[model samples]
Target: MSIAGLLIRRERLARAWSQEGLCRGICGTSYLSKIEQGKAAASEEVLALLFARLGLSWTDDADGALHAQTEACMEALFGGDAPAFAAAFARLRAQERTLLCSPCAADYLLLREFACEADGERRPLDAEFVSFLDQRQLALQRVLEGRHEEAALLYPAAAIRLWQGAHLYARGRYAAATEALRAAYDAAAAEGYAHIMMNCRVYLGNCCSDSGDPKRMQQHYAVAQRLAEALGDQKILSTIRYNDAATKIECGDFAAAYAYFSALEETDAMSLHKLAVCCEALGRRDEALTALARAEAMLPEGEAHAPERQMLALVRCRLETPDYLHDERYGTLLTDCFALLRRERGAGYARFHLKWMLKWYKANRRYREACALLEDFPAEK
Candidate 1:
């Protein structure tokens, strides 16, 4: 890895920033690209300017997690032996988790990262890696159902740990949230798996934004966006863009948010939802409705009742009637939709709305809908 990657990552770690965070800044990523390749070669004045805003640089001699992770991150930059670093990072990470599924779970994240990057292509290793992920997911199901207080004591419980971190961040718990994601990221990035690595960064940025940490948000966003761009995966990149836009909306850059959301219209689902939200946020309700309408038109009839379509209905519902109770029929529809999603959208497990229906129906008088959901839900684990 060149000095640019080192410096950029260094600054990012210092501020506890993520890619979506950095994307919020005026810096954009073009300058970041130059820094990573050592191509920009900023003048003394430019270096001074950076230090003022982002703080000091390593100049090849810095210490701490930033420097150490910088070295590890650099190895991945040039396409070296990723698993070595990934495995090493996993060992250290496994030791720190108060609750975990052991080192294998940590290794799974690393392996996922390695598989995502073109440089770390090795099939047998990938199969072994995926097996670990499958096991880890199973382990997670137990934790989610178990009481949270009981869980804090489990050793090396990686997935549950991250899930808790996500929960805390969403609920506005910044410091604890940071600690969790940072630990997970340190372990996973060492593996150099593109998807997991980027994902960790994205969630970390989400934490920062929720905490009102704009600078931190920008840093992580920048790195995540850069990594996604490097991986050249359209789907993942689009996801990063949607996330970045969401952060900007929170920051109140309505115009910029508008552009970011508009860009999503040209992409896929995450983009579609994000674009609709952005339009709605800007009081361009008509634009938002039209975008969702076009997306709805694009789907085949069978998929019209899919989660994506139904989620759009929720957003549309939000505009027409904000109260979950106002749209009395919505509870039934949402229960039915999530039931359909639980069967169809394999990755829809643990989604936000999945349990919303279950809990609401149980508490309120929607027992019929809840019963229908249970019966309609495909009998699968």
Candidate 2:
């Protein structure tokens, strides 16, 4: 069946509507059946009328208010536009709450979950939401298994996989995240879904960086960079550059890393924090201090004090003071930072910072503290 036919059937079933219920004032049951079966086409006017009766839209045009708004919100979220993402998410929440059968229900919830995480307010997933997403994933898997001609109907599967990857990646399940993103990449690439494919590739590259496979990491990054460059998407290009620089640091290419991080226009905590690392590597201690100061100034206090911001403070202390580790304030700061990382920053970042802490403590002959830390947070999982 055609993708539209599948959508109509799926939506109708979701609403518990029989063909008769849907065709009562639109078309005869026979014609509706033919349309659903893809044996006949529905005229634009008729399709719109049918969908309107079902409280759905057949068109994705700007005139279709819901679809347009959803698309705009998703775009804003992908672009990292905080205000726009928040606004869009608020509206989506209202819509999905009102209509559980909303056509883009899964999409809305997935984006909302990601936004919440990004905002540092990650909530536990609801049982109902998990059940709903599981159903959709199963349905998509069935379609894929059958090799249906309307495989495009399973396009949401790619999105589902992408978010799943993001969740795993945030939790430091780098290998699992790679698998999910790779699945998403394969599906999106098959459909020529450039935006989705590019995003999946970018994240796949990120997972590889943490996976400790330098060749694979750089290979994925190279592919993502090429695609972003070909698309002339400056935002994604910048993202690639940022990630590439971080990967370079992991690989001990400090000078090249400094060049990449220093060339970025972004002055946010994340960029500044990473740039500080690059600066420290190049022995530009003054510049590193400046970057950390700027990063610290940009962060708020209390619950809003992000893990990265805490890490930046620790880095600054390390650079400016020789006996920093022995200082109670700095020691407390490192302990608090490690706690934050373990609680909110995910496994990969937590492990990274913990190693640094251990190295610092051991190097400074703080053997007791180092041994205590190792006992408290054992690294061998």
Candidate 3:
């Protein structure tokens, strides 16, 4: 069926209207069905009347430039270049009327939904409309929801595999995540998908870092850094810098890590939080508390920020109770931290927190608590 016809049918079905109801006083039910089924061509007048009745819009004239610009917008979105995507989306919005009437209408709607999500303003896709989406789009939606397993099952597309690798990395499955990411990188390279390749390299670098292969991690980061520079994506470049500093923290190079984190522009809550971590490690207790407070202030009130809130609490406990082993509040914070860690689907942040907790328990001769913590989240085999 024609894309327009499919969109009409999907929208009509979403509204729970039957063909007869949709075509009443406009066209015969069979004729409408024929148009929907692509059994007959729809005339301009008939299509216009049908669209008007359904509160939709359509035009037979397709603008090639608009189509190209839409593709560019999607590229920016996928590349994780927020500024680029914002500028491109604004241009697309300026042509909204033409875009909605052109053949690119359905894709534009889907793109807008993705843009909304990227901006942290989620607008759930309609069930009927979602059903009409291609497998890749459905997989992307699932990935956005943190339903990575479901996303992995949708298709073996390169982008889907990239997300699969990322999810695996988060879950502490380093070897598997590395393998998946490498395969995805190869596929993306062959397909000339620069954005996917860059992302794959970034995740692969993370996997290497978490797996204790610092040299490999740096190599991957270097490649990703080059790609990010080539793409002119400052966001991903900053991310690479952050990850590199975090790896230094893992290596106990707190002084150098602190310098790096301090130099970074505190553009988000997590950046400030990372700064707090470095300060705490450097024995600058007061500075750490200030950064932590700033981080907490930036967080929004929602379940979505639950993990971040718990993390901030854990850090605050560390700062406030230097003698935590002898402090009653330590036990409560420890329990809460562990509970949140257990619920974590990824091991990235959890791994660091767990390490700190284990070290604290061991230094204070709390072997029993250490053993219990190990039992809850055993090290990767």
Highest lDDT scorer: 3
Superior by lDDT: candidate 2 or candidate 3: 3
Report the C-alpha lDDT of model 2 over 185-248, residue by residue, as the tens digit: 8877776656667787888877777666667767887888887788776778788877777777
Angstrom error of the Cα, residue 33, model 1: value is 64
Give the Cα error of residue 246 in candidate 1, in Å: 1.7
What TM-score number comes out for model 1? 0.40
State the lDDT of candidate 3 residue by residue for 1-381, as single tens digits. 345666678768889999999889988999998787666778878888888888877776544787798889877765555577888998988988767766666567767776674424655465544544567667666766667668778865667688788778877788888888888888888878788899999999998887777899999999999999998878799889889988888888889889987786555777777778889888899988988888899999988788888888878888888687667577677767666765753577776677777877886788998898777555341
Model 2, CA-based lDDT: 0.69
Off by over 4 Å in 3: 3-21, 30-44, 62-68, 72-87, 97-102, 117-124, 134-157, 265-268, 341-345, 360-381
Q: Which ten residues in a row have the lowest lDDT in candidate 1?
A: 97-106
Estimate the TM-score for candidate 3.
0.80
Q: Mind giving the per-residue lDDT tens digits that candidate 1 earns over 1-381?
A: 133344454556669976446534435567755654455665444444454455443232233443354335334422332455566455445433311222222333343443344421422332222222334333433333433323434433443455555555544455676677676566556655455556667778766655557688779888888887887656656666666666676566767878876754366654566567668768888888887887677666664336677767766775676565545677666666665655554322223354456666776777897787655333221
- Model 1: runs farther than 4 Å from truth? 1-175, 189-196, 230-234, 265-270, 280-285, 295-381
How much lDDT does each candidate structure score? Answer: 0.54, 0.69, 0.77
Clashing pairs in 3: 170-346, 170-347
> Model 1's lDDT to the true fold?
0.54
For candidate 2, which ten residues in a row score worst on lDDT?
143-152
